[model samples]
Target: MTSAPADSVDALIEAEFDKLDLNHDGRLDWADYEILIDRYRKTAGVNEDDRRIQELRAFYQLHWLELLRHSGAAGDSLSRNEFVEATRRTTGDTNRLDAAKVGGHVIFDLVDADGDGSISRDELGRYLQGVWQIDQSDPRYDFDALDTNKDGVISRDEFVTGIQEVLHA
Candidate 1:
Protein backbone atom coordinates (compact mmCIF):
# COMPACT_ATOMS: atom_id res chain seq x y z
CA MET A 1 0.00 0.00 0.00
CA THR A 2 1.22 3.46 -0.77
CA SER A 3 2.20 5.52 2.28
CA ALA A 4 1.26 9.10 2.98
CA PRO A 5 3.88 11.69 2.16
CA ALA A 6 6.30 12.71 4.92
CA ASP A 7 4.74 16.15 5.16
CA SER A 8 1.30 14.67 5.52
CA VAL A 9 2.53 12.34 8.24
CA ASP A 10 4.02 15.24 10.11
CA ALA A 11 0.79 17.13 9.73
CA LEU A 12 -1.14 14.20 11.10
CA ILE A 13 1.15 13.92 14.06
CA GLU A 14 0.91 17.62 14.70
CA ALA A 15 -2.85 17.49 14.60
CA GLU A 16 -2.89 14.64 17.10
CA PHE A 17 -0.43 16.42 19.32
CA ASP A 18 -2.57 19.52 19.25
CA LYS A 19 -5.57 17.51 20.30
CA LEU A 20 -3.65 15.89 23.14
CA ASP A 21 -2.21 19.15 24.33
CA LEU A 22 -5.35 19.94 26.23
CA ASN A 23 -4.14 23.11 27.88
CA HIS A 24 -2.70 24.46 24.67
CA ASP A 25 0.60 25.10 26.41
CA GLY A 26 2.62 23.61 23.59
CA ARG A 27 3.79 20.83 25.93
CA LEU A 28 2.62 17.41 26.93
CA ASP A 29 2.67 16.20 30.50
CA TRP A 30 0.90 13.91 32.92
CA ALA A 31 -1.83 16.48 33.38
CA ASP A 32 -2.59 16.40 29.68
CA TYR A 33 -2.77 12.62 29.77
CA GLU A 34 -5.03 12.69 32.80
CA ILE A 35 -7.42 14.97 30.97
CA LEU A 36 -7.39 12.60 28.03
CA ILE A 37 -8.20 9.67 30.29
CA ASP A 38 -11.00 11.66 31.83
CA ARG A 39 -12.39 12.39 28.39
CA TYR A 40 -12.39 8.70 27.56
CA ARG A 41 -14.06 7.91 30.83
CA LYS A 42 -16.75 10.48 30.27
CA THR A 43 -17.23 9.51 26.65
CA ALA A 44 -17.53 5.83 27.48
CA GLY A 45 -19.79 6.64 30.41
CA VAL A 46 -17.59 4.52 32.63
CA ASN A 47 -16.70 5.51 36.13
CA GLU A 48 -13.15 5.45 37.43
CA ASP A 49 -13.96 2.10 39.08
CA ASP A 50 -14.73 0.47 35.77
CA ARG A 51 -12.13 -2.00 34.49
CA ARG A 52 -12.19 -0.50 31.04
CA ILE A 53 -11.51 2.93 32.43
CA GLN A 54 -8.72 1.54 34.55
CA GLU A 55 -7.17 -0.13 31.53
CA LEU A 56 -7.43 3.08 29.58
CA ARG A 57 -5.63 4.92 32.37
CA ALA A 58 -2.90 2.32 32.47
CA PHE A 59 -2.48 2.51 28.72
CA TYR A 60 -2.13 6.25 28.86
CA GLN A 61 0.41 5.99 31.65
CA LEU A 62 2.53 3.57 29.68
CA HIS A 63 2.18 5.60 26.52
CA TRP A 64 3.13 8.78 28.32
CA LEU A 65 6.17 7.20 29.87
CA GLU A 66 7.25 5.86 26.53
CA LEU A 67 6.89 9.26 24.95
CA LEU A 68 8.82 10.93 27.75
CA ARG A 69 11.56 8.34 27.59
CA HIS A 70 12.01 8.87 23.91
CA SER A 71 11.45 12.60 23.96
CA GLY A 72 15.00 13.46 25.08
CA ALA A 73 13.70 16.63 26.63
CA ALA A 74 15.31 18.26 29.67
CA GLY A 75 12.02 18.61 31.50
CA ASP A 76 9.36 16.18 32.61
CA SER A 77 7.09 17.42 29.84
CA LEU A 78 7.65 17.35 26.09
CA SER A 79 7.63 20.35 23.80
CA ARG A 80 5.74 20.26 20.54
CA ASN A 81 8.75 19.31 18.49
CA GLU A 82 9.84 16.78 21.09
CA PHE A 83 6.41 15.24 21.12
CA VAL A 84 6.27 14.97 17.33
CA GLU A 85 9.70 13.34 17.11
CA ALA A 86 9.10 11.01 20.02
CA THR A 87 5.75 9.89 18.61
CA ARG A 88 7.34 9.16 15.24
CA ARG A 89 10.04 7.07 16.83
CA THR A 90 7.78 5.38 19.39
CA THR A 91 5.09 4.42 16.87
CA GLY A 92 7.70 3.21 14.38
CA ASP A 93 9.60 1.12 16.93
CA THR A 94 7.27 -1.81 17.12
CA ASN A 95 9.94 -3.90 18.79
CA ARG A 96 9.67 -1.74 21.88
CA LEU A 97 6.03 -0.74 21.68
CA ASP A 98 3.48 -1.98 19.19
CA ALA A 99 1.43 1.21 19.50
CA ALA A 100 -1.25 0.08 17.09
CA LYS A 101 -1.75 -3.20 18.93
CA VAL A 102 -1.71 -1.96 22.49
CA GLY A 103 -3.37 1.36 21.88
CA GLY A 104 -5.85 -0.07 19.43
CA HIS A 105 -6.94 -2.75 21.88
CA VAL A 106 -7.49 -0.27 24.68
CA ILE A 107 -9.36 2.12 22.39
CA PHE A 108 -11.42 -0.63 20.89
CA ASP A 109 -12.29 -1.98 24.30
CA LEU A 110 -13.46 1.42 25.42
CA VAL A 111 -15.36 2.09 22.23
CA ASP A 112 -17.10 -1.29 22.43
CA ALA A 113 -19.62 -0.04 24.97
CA ASP A 114 -21.75 -3.18 24.97
CA GLY A 115 -18.79 -5.35 26.01
CA ASP A 116 -19.57 -7.47 22.99
CA GLY A 117 -15.98 -7.56 21.68
CA SER A 118 -17.04 -5.55 18.67
CA ILE A 119 -17.95 -1.97 17.84
CA SER A 120 -21.33 -1.13 16.46
CA ARG A 121 -21.83 1.98 14.36
CA ASP A 122 -23.75 3.62 17.18
CA GLU A 123 -21.02 2.90 19.68
CA LEU A 124 -18.45 4.36 17.33
CA GLY A 125 -20.64 7.37 16.82
CA ARG A 126 -20.82 8.00 20.54
CA TYR A 127 -17.06 7.76 20.82
CA LEU A 128 -16.51 10.11 17.91
CA GLN A 129 -18.99 12.56 19.28
CA GLY A 130 -17.98 12.44 22.93
CA VAL A 131 -14.25 11.87 22.77
CA TRP A 132 -13.13 13.20 19.42
CA GLN A 133 -15.95 15.73 19.41
CA ILE A 134 -16.40 15.10 15.72
CA ASP A 135 -19.58 16.22 14.06
CA GLN A 136 -21.95 13.28 13.69
CA SER A 137 -23.02 14.78 10.39
CA ASP A 138 -19.63 14.12 8.82
CA PRO A 139 -19.77 11.34 6.26
CA ARG A 140 -16.02 10.92 6.05
CA TYR A 141 -15.97 9.08 9.35
CA ASP A 142 -18.10 6.27 7.96
CA PHE A 143 -17.74 2.85 9.59
CA ASP A 144 -17.17 1.22 6.20
CA ALA A 145 -13.61 2.47 6.16
CA LEU A 146 -12.63 0.46 9.21
CA ASP A 147 -15.05 -2.42 8.85
CA THR A 148 -12.96 -4.15 6.20
CA ASN A 149 -15.00 -7.37 6.45
CA LYS A 150 -18.22 -5.35 6.15
CA ASP A 151 -19.82 -7.50 8.82
CA GLY A 152 -21.83 -4.58 10.21
CA VAL A 153 -19.37 -4.05 13.07
CA ILE A 154 -15.73 -3.29 13.62
CA SER A 155 -13.81 -6.28 14.92
CA ARG A 156 -10.67 -5.99 16.99
CA ASP A 157 -8.50 -7.01 14.06
CA GLU A 158 -10.07 -4.48 11.76
CA PHE A 159 -9.71 -1.74 14.36
CA VAL A 160 -6.07 -2.56 14.98
CA THR A 161 -5.25 -2.76 11.30
CA GLY A 162 -6.92 0.60 10.70
CA ILE A 163 -4.85 2.18 13.46
CA GLN A 164 -1.67 0.54 12.13
CA GLU A 165 -2.31 1.86 8.67
CA VAL A 166 -2.85 5.37 10.00
CA LEU A 167 0.29 5.28 12.11
CA HIS A 168 2.45 4.02 9.28
CA ALA A 169 0.76 6.11 6.64
Candidate 2:
Protein backbone atom coordinates (compact mmCIF):
# COMPACT_ATOMS: atom_id res chain seq x y z
CA MET A 1 0.00 0.00 0.00
CA THR A 2 1.06 3.54 -0.70
CA SER A 3 2.12 5.15 2.55
CA ALA A 4 1.59 8.60 3.94
CA PRO A 5 4.12 11.34 3.34
CA ALA A 6 7.48 11.02 5.08
CA ASP A 7 6.70 13.86 7.45
CA SER A 8 3.32 12.34 8.22
CA VAL A 9 4.77 8.98 9.14
CA ASP A 10 7.43 10.70 11.21
CA ALA A 11 4.83 12.54 13.20
CA LEU A 12 2.85 9.38 13.90
CA ILE A 13 5.90 7.48 15.01
CA GLU A 14 6.83 10.29 17.34
CA ALA A 15 3.38 10.18 18.89
CA GLU A 16 3.59 6.44 19.44
CA PHE A 17 7.02 6.77 20.94
CA ASP A 18 5.68 9.42 23.26
CA LYS A 19 2.80 7.24 24.32
CA LEU A 20 5.05 4.25 24.91
CA ASP A 21 7.77 6.36 26.36
CA LEU A 22 6.20 6.59 29.78
CA ASN A 23 9.21 8.26 31.33
CA HIS A 24 8.72 11.32 29.08
CA ASP A 25 12.37 11.18 28.03
CA GLY A 26 11.45 11.75 24.36
CA ARG A 27 12.99 8.35 23.58
CA LEU A 28 12.09 4.72 24.15
CA ASP A 29 14.20 2.43 26.33
CA TRP A 30 13.78 -0.89 28.13
CA ALA A 31 13.17 0.91 31.40
CA ASP A 32 10.29 2.79 29.80
CA TYR A 33 8.96 -0.48 28.44
CA GLU A 34 8.78 -2.01 31.91
CA ILE A 35 6.79 0.92 33.17
CA LEU A 36 4.50 0.67 30.19
CA ILE A 37 3.91 -3.03 30.66
CA ASP A 38 3.21 -2.71 34.33
CA ARG A 39 0.78 0.12 33.79
CA TYR A 40 -0.93 -1.57 30.88
CA ARG A 41 -1.40 -4.83 32.76
CA LYS A 42 -2.49 -3.02 35.88
CA THR A 43 -5.17 -1.15 33.96
CA ALA A 44 -6.34 -4.41 32.50
CA GLY A 45 -6.10 -6.04 35.90
CA VAL A 46 -3.91 -8.79 34.50
CA ASN A 47 -0.43 -10.00 35.24
CA GLU A 48 1.67 -11.08 32.32
CA ASP A 49 4.02 -13.89 33.14
CA ASP A 50 7.62 -13.96 31.95
CA ARG A 51 6.92 -16.03 28.86
CA ARG A 52 4.24 -13.68 27.62
CA ILE A 53 6.44 -10.69 28.34
CA GLN A 54 9.13 -12.17 26.12
CA GLU A 55 6.58 -12.81 23.43
CA LEU A 56 5.41 -9.17 23.57
CA ARG A 57 8.98 -7.95 23.32
CA ALA A 58 9.57 -10.06 20.23
CA PHE A 59 6.41 -8.72 18.63
CA TYR A 60 7.44 -5.14 19.33
CA GLN A 61 10.82 -5.78 17.78
CA LEU A 62 9.15 -6.97 14.63
CA HIS A 63 6.87 -3.94 14.63
CA TRP A 64 9.78 -1.55 15.08
CA LEU A 65 11.58 -3.14 12.19
CA GLU A 66 8.55 -2.94 9.95
CA LEU A 67 7.93 0.73 10.65
CA LEU A 68 11.55 1.65 10.25
CA ARG A 69 11.80 -0.22 6.97
CA HIS A 70 8.54 0.94 5.44
CA SER A 71 7.69 4.40 6.67
CA GLY A 72 10.73 5.72 8.42
CA ALA A 73 14.02 7.11 7.22
CA ALA A 74 17.25 5.84 8.71
CA GLY A 75 17.32 7.00 12.33
CA ASP A 76 13.95 8.63 11.73
CA SER A 77 10.93 7.79 13.85
CA LEU A 78 7.49 7.26 12.28
CA SER A 79 4.92 9.99 11.70
CA ARG A 80 1.40 9.78 13.06
CA ASN A 81 -0.19 8.85 9.76
CA GLU A 82 2.25 6.07 9.07
CA PHE A 83 1.97 4.79 12.62
CA VAL A 84 -1.81 4.74 12.39
CA GLU A 85 -1.69 2.75 9.19
CA ALA A 86 0.77 0.30 10.65
CA THR A 87 -1.31 -0.16 13.79
CA ARG A 88 -4.48 -0.61 11.76
CA ARG A 89 -2.89 -3.39 9.79
CA THR A 90 -1.82 -5.14 12.96
CA THR A 91 -5.05 -4.61 14.94
CA GLY A 92 -7.55 -4.56 12.07
CA ASP A 93 -9.52 -1.54 10.97
CA THR A 94 -11.98 0.12 13.30
CA ASN A 95 -13.64 2.28 10.68
CA ARG A 96 -15.76 -0.42 9.12
CA LEU A 97 -18.72 -2.27 10.57
CA ASP A 98 -17.81 -5.23 8.42
CA ALA A 99 -14.51 -5.39 10.25
CA ALA A 100 -16.25 -5.29 13.59
CA LYS A 101 -18.64 -7.99 12.46
CA VAL A 102 -15.74 -10.17 11.45
CA GLY A 103 -13.97 -9.52 14.73
CA GLY A 104 -17.06 -10.51 16.69
CA HIS A 105 -17.43 -13.60 14.55
CA VAL A 106 -13.88 -14.57 15.35
CA ILE A 107 -14.53 -14.20 19.04
CA PHE A 108 -17.85 -15.95 18.76
CA ASP A 109 -16.38 -18.85 16.89
CA LEU A 110 -13.72 -19.18 19.53
CA VAL A 111 -16.33 -19.27 22.30
CA ASP A 112 -18.75 -21.70 20.69
CA ALA A 113 -17.47 -24.78 22.47
CA ASP A 114 -20.39 -27.05 21.65
CA GLY A 115 -21.25 -25.49 18.31
CA ASP A 116 -24.63 -24.88 19.89
CA GLY A 117 -24.62 -21.12 19.27
CA SER A 118 -23.31 -20.19 22.72
CA ILE A 119 -19.86 -19.55 24.11
CA SER A 120 -18.34 -21.71 26.81
CA ARG A 121 -15.08 -21.76 28.74
CA ASP A 122 -13.35 -24.37 26.60
CA GLU A 123 -13.97 -22.37 23.46
CA LEU A 124 -12.87 -19.17 25.15
CA GLY A 125 -9.47 -20.51 26.22
CA ARG A 126 -8.81 -21.75 22.71
CA TYR A 127 -9.77 -18.37 21.30
CA LEU A 128 -7.35 -16.55 23.58
CA GLN A 129 -4.55 -18.94 22.65
CA GLY A 130 -5.28 -18.37 19.00
CA VAL A 131 -5.48 -14.60 19.38
CA TRP A 132 -2.15 -14.49 21.22
CA GLN A 133 -0.56 -17.05 18.87
CA ILE A 134 0.10 -19.38 21.75
CA ASP A 135 1.02 -22.96 20.98
CA GLN A 136 -1.30 -25.59 22.35
CA SER A 137 -0.80 -29.21 21.53
CA ASP A 138 -3.89 -30.12 23.50
CA PRO A 139 -6.00 -27.24 24.84
CA ARG A 140 -5.65 -24.06 26.79
CA TYR A 141 -5.84 -23.99 30.55
CA ASP A 142 -7.30 -20.47 30.64
CA PHE A 143 -10.79 -21.81 31.09
CA ASP A 144 -9.75 -23.77 34.14
CA ALA A 145 -7.76 -20.86 35.45
CA LEU A 146 -10.30 -18.04 34.98
CA ASP A 147 -13.52 -19.84 35.51
CA THR A 148 -13.73 -18.78 39.12
CA ASN A 149 -17.32 -19.87 39.59
CA LYS A 150 -16.68 -23.26 38.00
CA ASP A 151 -19.82 -22.86 35.99
CA GLY A 152 -20.35 -24.95 32.89
CA VAL A 153 -19.89 -21.85 30.76
CA ILE A 154 -18.03 -18.62 31.10
CA SER A 155 -20.21 -15.54 30.83
CA ARG A 156 -19.54 -12.95 28.14
CA ASP A 157 -18.06 -10.57 30.68
CA GLU A 158 -15.76 -13.27 31.95
CA PHE A 159 -14.61 -14.08 28.45
CA VAL A 160 -13.76 -10.45 27.69
CA THR A 161 -12.00 -9.91 31.00
CA GLY A 162 -10.04 -13.13 30.63
CA ILE A 163 -8.72 -12.21 27.20
CA GLN A 164 -7.89 -8.66 28.26
CA GLU A 165 -6.09 -10.02 31.32
CA VAL A 166 -3.96 -12.36 29.29
CA LEU A 167 -3.25 -9.82 26.57
CA HIS A 168 -2.08 -7.12 28.94
CA ALA A 169 -0.71 -9.60 31.40
Candidate 3:
Protein backbone atom coordinates (compact mmCIF):
# COMPACT_ATOMS: atom_id res chain seq x y z
CA MET A 1 0.00 0.00 0.00
CA THR A 2 1.14 3.51 -0.64
CA SER A 3 1.97 5.49 2.48
CA ALA A 4 0.11 8.68 3.18
CA PRO A 5 2.11 11.84 3.29
CA ALA A 6 3.73 12.37 6.68
CA ASP A 7 1.89 15.64 7.16
CA SER A 8 -1.46 14.01 6.56
CA VAL A 9 -0.68 11.16 8.89
CA ASP A 10 0.42 13.53 11.60
CA ALA A 11 -2.74 15.58 11.18
CA LEU A 12 -4.87 12.48 11.40
CA ILE A 13 -3.23 11.34 14.58
CA GLU A 14 -3.60 14.79 16.05
CA ALA A 15 -7.30 14.83 15.24
CA GLU A 16 -7.74 11.45 16.88
CA PHE A 17 -5.97 12.65 19.97
CA ASP A 18 -8.38 15.56 20.11
CA LYS A 19 -11.29 13.17 20.02
CA LEU A 20 -9.90 11.15 22.88
CA ASP A 21 -9.29 14.18 25.05
CA LEU A 22 -13.05 14.00 25.79
CA ASN A 23 -13.38 16.90 28.20
CA HIS A 24 -12.13 19.61 25.87
CA ASP A 25 -9.27 20.01 28.29
CA GLY A 26 -6.53 20.04 25.63
CA ARG A 27 -4.75 17.09 27.25
CA LEU A 28 -5.37 13.50 28.20
CA ASP A 29 -4.77 12.43 31.75
CA TRP A 30 -5.69 9.41 33.88
CA ALA A 31 -8.82 11.13 35.07
CA ASP A 32 -10.03 11.71 31.53
CA TYR A 33 -9.53 8.04 30.75
CA GLU A 34 -11.27 7.00 33.93
CA ILE A 35 -14.22 9.16 33.00
CA LEU A 36 -14.49 7.32 29.69
CA ILE A 37 -14.21 3.93 31.35
CA ASP A 38 -16.89 4.83 33.83
CA ARG A 39 -19.21 5.95 31.07
CA TYR A 40 -18.71 2.64 29.26
CA ARG A 41 -19.19 0.62 32.39
CA LYS A 42 -22.50 2.32 32.91
CA THR A 43 -23.47 1.89 29.27
CA ALA A 44 -22.76 -1.83 29.55
CA GLY A 45 -25.65 -1.96 32.03
CA VAL A 46 -25.86 -3.24 35.55
CA ASN A 47 -26.48 -6.76 34.31
CA GLU A 48 -23.02 -6.98 32.83
CA ASP A 49 -20.76 -9.39 34.69
CA ASP A 50 -18.24 -7.95 37.10
CA ARG A 51 -15.48 -10.12 35.67
CA ARG A 52 -15.97 -8.73 32.20
CA ILE A 53 -16.07 -5.19 33.51
CA GLN A 54 -12.88 -5.75 35.42
CA GLU A 55 -11.18 -7.20 32.41
CA LEU A 56 -12.18 -4.23 30.29
CA ARG A 57 -11.01 -1.88 33.01
CA ALA A 58 -7.65 -3.57 33.12
CA PHE A 59 -7.30 -3.40 29.38
CA TYR A 60 -8.15 0.29 29.27
CA GLN A 61 -5.71 1.00 32.05
CA LEU A 62 -2.92 -0.69 30.18
CA HIS A 63 -3.90 0.98 26.97
CA TRP A 64 -3.79 4.37 28.63
CA LEU A 65 -0.45 3.70 30.27
CA GLU A 66 1.03 2.33 27.10
CA LEU A 67 0.10 5.42 25.18
CA LEU A 68 1.59 7.60 27.87
CA ARG A 69 4.76 5.55 27.86
CA HIS A 70 5.02 5.78 24.12
CA SER A 71 4.87 9.54 24.44
CA GLY A 72 7.64 9.31 27.03
CA ALA A 73 5.31 10.97 29.48
CA ALA A 74 4.27 7.94 31.49
CA GLY A 75 3.83 9.73 34.80
CA ASP A 76 1.96 12.61 33.27
CA SER A 77 -0.62 13.55 30.69
CA LEU A 78 -0.05 14.02 26.96
CA SER A 79 -0.74 17.10 24.92
CA ARG A 80 -1.58 16.74 21.23
CA ASN A 81 1.97 17.53 20.25
CA GLU A 82 3.37 14.82 22.48
CA PHE A 83 0.92 12.25 21.17
CA VAL A 84 1.51 13.15 17.54
CA GLU A 85 5.26 13.00 18.04
CA ALA A 86 5.07 9.57 19.60
CA THR A 87 2.91 8.28 16.77
CA ARG A 88 5.27 9.74 14.19
CA ARG A 89 8.19 8.00 15.87
CA THR A 90 6.44 4.66 15.49
CA THR A 91 6.04 5.20 11.76
CA GLY A 92 9.76 5.39 11.11
CA ASP A 93 12.69 2.92 10.98
CA THR A 94 13.03 -0.83 11.69
CA ASN A 95 12.92 -0.49 15.47
CA ARG A 96 9.81 1.65 15.19
CA LEU A 97 8.20 -1.01 12.97
CA ASP A 98 8.91 -3.67 15.58
CA ALA A 99 7.46 -1.52 18.34
CA ALA A 100 4.40 -0.74 16.29
CA LYS A 101 3.86 -4.44 15.57
CA VAL A 102 4.08 -5.30 19.25
CA GLY A 103 1.65 -2.52 20.12
CA GLY A 104 -0.73 -3.75 17.44
CA HIS A 105 -0.62 -7.28 18.88
CA VAL A 106 -1.40 -5.96 22.32
CA ILE A 107 -4.45 -4.12 21.02
CA PHE A 108 -5.63 -7.17 19.07
CA ASP A 109 -5.33 -9.33 22.15
CA LEU A 110 -7.28 -6.78 24.17
CA VAL A 111 -10.14 -6.67 21.69
CA ASP A 112 -10.28 -10.42 21.17
CA ALA A 113 -12.26 -10.79 24.38
CA ASP A 114 -13.01 -14.51 24.02
CA GLY A 115 -9.35 -15.28 23.41
CA ASP A 116 -10.38 -17.25 20.33
CA GLY A 117 -7.57 -15.66 18.31
CA SER A 118 -9.98 -13.48 16.40
CA ILE A 119 -12.14 -10.43 16.96
CA SER A 120 -15.79 -10.63 16.17
CA ARG A 121 -17.87 -7.60 15.29
CA ASP A 122 -19.50 -7.66 18.69
CA GLU A 123 -16.19 -7.74 20.49
CA LEU A 124 -14.83 -4.88 18.43
CA GLY A 125 -17.93 -2.82 19.07
CA ARG A 126 -17.76 -3.39 22.79
CA TYR A 127 -14.07 -2.59 22.89
CA LEU A 128 -14.64 0.62 20.99
CA GLN A 129 -17.31 1.62 23.46
CA GLY A 130 -15.38 0.83 26.60
CA VAL A 131 -11.90 1.91 25.65
CA TRP A 132 -12.26 4.60 23.04
CA GLN A 133 -15.59 5.96 24.20
CA ILE A 134 -16.87 5.16 20.74
CA ASP A 135 -20.51 4.27 21.09
CA GLN A 136 -22.18 1.43 19.22
CA SER A 137 -23.66 4.10 16.98
CA ASP A 138 -20.20 5.15 15.90
CA PRO A 139 -17.48 2.71 14.98
CA ARG A 140 -13.96 3.93 15.54
CA TYR A 141 -12.34 2.10 12.66
CA ASP A 142 -13.28 0.75 9.29
CA PHE A 143 -14.51 -2.68 10.29
CA ASP A 144 -14.82 -3.78 6.67
CA ALA A 145 -11.25 -2.87 5.89
CA LEU A 146 -9.91 -4.57 8.97
CA ASP A 147 -11.76 -7.81 8.21
CA THR A 148 -9.64 -8.06 5.02
CA ASN A 149 -10.98 -11.48 3.92
CA LYS A 150 -14.64 -10.54 4.25
CA ASP A 151 -14.92 -13.34 6.81
CA GLY A 152 -16.77 -11.24 9.41
CA VAL A 153 -13.94 -11.76 11.87
CA ILE A 154 -10.57 -10.11 12.32
CA SER A 155 -7.80 -12.57 12.90
CA ARG A 156 -4.59 -11.48 14.61
CA ASP A 157 -2.89 -11.34 11.25
CA GLU A 158 -5.50 -9.00 9.92
CA PHE A 159 -5.39 -6.76 12.95
CA VAL A 160 -1.62 -6.42 12.93
CA THR A 161 -1.18 -6.14 9.22
CA GLY A 162 -4.10 -3.78 8.88
CA ILE A 163 -2.69 -1.58 11.60
CA GLN A 164 0.66 -1.47 9.84
CA GLU A 165 -1.00 -0.63 6.59
CA VAL A 166 -2.96 2.13 8.23
CA LEU A 167 0.10 3.56 9.88
CA HIS A 168 2.12 3.61 6.71
CA ALA A 169 -0.77 4.67 4.56
Q: Name the best candidate (by lDDT).
A: 1
Best by TM-score: 1
Instruction: Report lDDT (Cα) of residue 47, candidate 3.
Output: 29
Per-residue lDDT tens digits for candidate 2, residues 85-144, read 554443332332222233344344334545575566545545545433334333434555
Which runs of model 2 end up more than 4 angstroms from their true locations? 50-54, 61-169
lDDT of 3 by residue, 1-169 (tens): 6777889888878877876787888988878766765655564553245555565566557656556657887558888888887666645544423544665775665577677999998987887766675665554386777898999999999998987776666
TM-score of each: 0.93, 0.35, 0.65
Cα RMSD for candidate 1? 1.5
Worst 10 residues of 2 by lDDT: 92-101
> Which candidate model has the greater TM-score, 2 or 3?
3
- Candidate 3 ranges beyond 4 A from true positions: 22-24, 29-77, 93-97, 135-140
lDDT of 1: 0.86
lDDT-wise, the better of 1 and 3 is: 1
Superposed on all Cα atoms, the candidates' RMSDs to the truth, in angstroms, are: 1.5, 13.2, 4.7
* CA displacement after TM-score superposition, residue 148 of candidate 2 (Å): 34
lDDT per residue, candidate 1, 66-103, as tens digits?
Answer: 88888888788988789889988888877767877898
Task: List the pairs of residues colliding in candidate 1.
Answer: none
